[model samples]
Target chain A: MRRLLPALIALALLTGLSLLVGATNLFDSPLDRSMVLAVSRLPRTMAAILAGAGLALAGVVIQQTMRNRLVEPGLTGTPEAAMIGLLGVTLLAPGAALLTKMSVAALSALLGTAGFFALSTRVPRRDPMLLPLVGLIYGGILGAAALFIAWSTDLVQFVGIWQTGDFSGVLRGRYELLWLIAALAGLLWLFTDRLTILGLGEDRARALGLNVRQTVLAGLTIVAIAVAVVVVTVGAMPFVGLVVPNIVSRLWGDNLRDNLGLVAVMGGGFVLASDVIGRLVRWPYEIPAATIFAIGGAAIFLWLLNHPKAHAHG
Target chain B: MIDIDHLTLERDGRVILDDISLRLPRGGITAIIGPNGAGKSTLLHCLAGLLAPRSGRVRVLGRDIHHIPARERARLLALLTQSPGTVPRLSVRDLVAFGRWPHHRGRPGPTDHALVAQALERFALTPLAARDVETLSGGQKQRAFVAMAYAQSTPWMLLDEPLSALDPKYIRDIMDRLRDLAPPRHGLTEAPAASRSVLLVLHDLQIAWRYADWFVCLKDGKLLAHGPRDTTVTADLLSALYDTPLRLERVSDSSVILPA
Candidate 1:
């Protein structure tokens, strides 16, 4: 809990700053101060926090389940699969309810993740870096397919919104689906021990009386739902999942049951800070949070690739 | 006692363990020795109920090993595979505590805590309990893993090459610990507390000769010899098992195997 103090403080300060630094200044504007906070500012901050936490949780789950720290929900074709589902729903029933669209996205994301897992087995195990490379290419193919479909159907603008993570359009009613991430995090808490066992690999997990198949399916399902919900509500944030869990795991170790809360807080803090920076960089004009995360995330990813010794087991 | 009757396992149209049968009496360290590709680890997996044989069965303490549920089997016997993959970034204490998982099934009780603490103390890992397992040296990590299996508190342990890459110091350290903790007790239906029968696959002949009380030799997936080490193991059998000329020699206080 003491380790969480710094993250909690940073998150609280970011939340305060997020509410204050909008186009309509709370102190000077004619708009009703309370209405803006309730409708836009509060929901935006909560959406960022929820999405960041959920992605980080998803990243850790997939990493443990796959026994590879280099992969994340973004690289595993999860968000791309969700995009395909959203495109299909939008084409079939443009006026479908948000819940229905989210359900479809979640289902497709699960299938996509499952497909990647199937592909992962065929990749040779001698090189740990190979799996993530395969995941990246797999995600790229799915993403290209989604882009092609969007172009043909004239849903390109909608795809852009889901591809780029921005908080400018968030309001109370628009972003509630991200709250599903909170519930997913709670569900993960229940299976923390099981997930830790999974990192030990199939034979050891089986020897320890863990039903490896069941635990892995449960973990991947949670990842799919979290990634899909975040994408449908606030668009895809690429490296929040990839970078945050790696950082936390390096700092506090991989005791999932003990560090779940810390991972969530740190994830929320990182993304919120990114969003705040994106907002401040151009003042009235805004940059997407995903853009800022990518710039930082790619650098960290490169460092991780170079420093494989830090992750080597024996 | 473990009763193996006509046990056979085939993988990808290749017979790994051909028709083989043996009764392994409980107590003492039983070493399964064989050359490369002799199906030693495969047989260990079958005994642990992690793999099912194509024909015949293995019975542990009169119950069909494969027929038992996973959790119940875990309680009955613990298995440690060769060079366990993916070093989880867990602390030494937490890794050892995982041994009590079968008993608690996620919610550990006082007994589990006591056993984990006892296991750490017995393995002399109290000083490193808070250290991440990944940071430990090879010997220390092997000891930590051994402690984990020890903490499982099962009546039987099946280990695949536990001393494969360890130095003589660690090998002797672990063998001595196991010997003192689970000395062979003859003709007893019930095992006393802290006593376990260990079955392991070994590649180091000298270490096996020094530590193992019984020998089970395999070659080309067929059992060649098995019984008390003094009676069943000979220089000729050792040579046949590895297809290399070897002689059993008395080296002062203990016997050692050397190429003839």
Candidate 2:
């Protein structure tokens, strides 16, 4: 709770800044502010916050279920797979509504994630660390396939396209789908301890009358949907999941119920900070949210790796 | 009562347990002792319904354990395998509290907390209950796991090498706890209230001989001996079980098999 105060205060300041400043000078008057705030900043910040919270929560679930600390939705190819699905929907169903596209992307991401888990289990070696390695290799393979598809198509430039998640285009209709992340996060919070128990190891769970495989499938499903939702709405933003959960766990230790709540709040704060930084770093020449996050996240990950106290759980 | 008739377990086309038949009395600790790779663990898995026999059946209290609903079966018996995966950050109290999950699902009530408290005190984990299980010493961690199993309050506890890594003190502590445990809500007519039955895959012959009321021995996936310890745990049988000459020493409660 003490540590949470600082984070909460930081979140308020950064999120407000993220909402006020955009492509140009900040408006001071209430009447002057409502239009800019409503049009661009609100949608963008909301998108960023929802994506951040959802991805981080998904990361915590994946890492726990696999019993591997380094594992995340990004590491396991859920985001990449969802990106591919989003691209496909944009191409094949270009006439479809955004809602339909998001749903298609989510479903494809779910299948792809299940495929990754299935292929990983069949690799003759089920070492926990092998999960991320296998997932990376597996994602690389699917990425190549996605690349091949892109090359064969005339829509290659538009194939892996994204809106920059800056919410420059978001209105009432565009940003509404982003609110689904809150619902997903709520469901996860309700079942947090159950997932933790499932992750402790299957034999113990089985002895306690948990349907081990069912619980695992449920966890994987949650991760899949969360990744897909973020990817469809915001494009490929890696490491939000990895970064948020790792930071929260270190600060609070690993009590799932509490850690999950912290992950959502910190996740929202992280994306907001990144978005604000992205807006300021280039000023008029705005930086993309994904690129800004990539640089910052990579630095944090490198620092984590070099830290002597850090064990292999980033 | 567990009645097993012609039970066989095969893995990857290799027999791990062959045509074994036995009727275990409802209320006695039955030790499954054998040399390494003698299907001791496999038999325990089959009994716990975690694995199915290729060709036979295991009836626990007249119910086919393997075919029963997993949750119901878990309520009846608990299986603790060796080297159960470590949960990096859960506390002793939370881990043990999981044992009550079968009864309560995710909604642990006051009874669950009460049971966890009782289990913590019973296992002397009150001080360590709130600490991360990963931070515990080996013996403490083993005791924590045993306490979790005990918290299950099942009629039969099937443990696979529960004493492998512990020092002598942990081994004795765990053994004494097992001996003194009472299977919850089970008031047997013949087996006294404080007596719990355990089916353990034990390597240390002395501990088995001293603590177990009955014995079963296996060699190369086949049953070699079963029944009263005095008759089955003979010096000749012990030597044959390990393929070496062995000597026996009579202790106060039982005897020890030592290699020659």
Best by DockQ: 1
Write the residue-wise lDDT of candidate 1 on A107-179 in tens digits: 9999999999888878888888899999999999999999999999999888898888877788999999998
The residue-by-residue lDDT of candidate 2 on B1-260, one tens digit each, is 78888999999999999999987876666789888899998898888888888898999889888778988988888888786555556678877887887778778899889999999999999988878777788889988888888788787888889999789998999888887773322232357544567888888888887777788899999999888776667889889988989889877756667877
Estimate the TM-score for candidate 1: 0.96
The native-contact fractions of the candidates, in order shown, are 0.75, 0.59
Candidate 1: clashing pairs of residues: none
> Over the stretch A147-210, how does candidate 2's per-residue lDDT look in tens digits?
6667777656543554234444555557777788899888887778777776677666676677
Q: What is the C-alpha lDDT of each candidate?
A: 0.88, 0.77
* Candidate 1 residue lDDT tens string, B75-141: 8888888996569898999999998898899899999999999999999999989888988988889
State residue A306's C-alpha deviation in candidate 2, in Å: 5.5
Q: What is the lDDT of residue A197 in candidate 1?
A: 89
TM-score of each: 0.96, 0.92
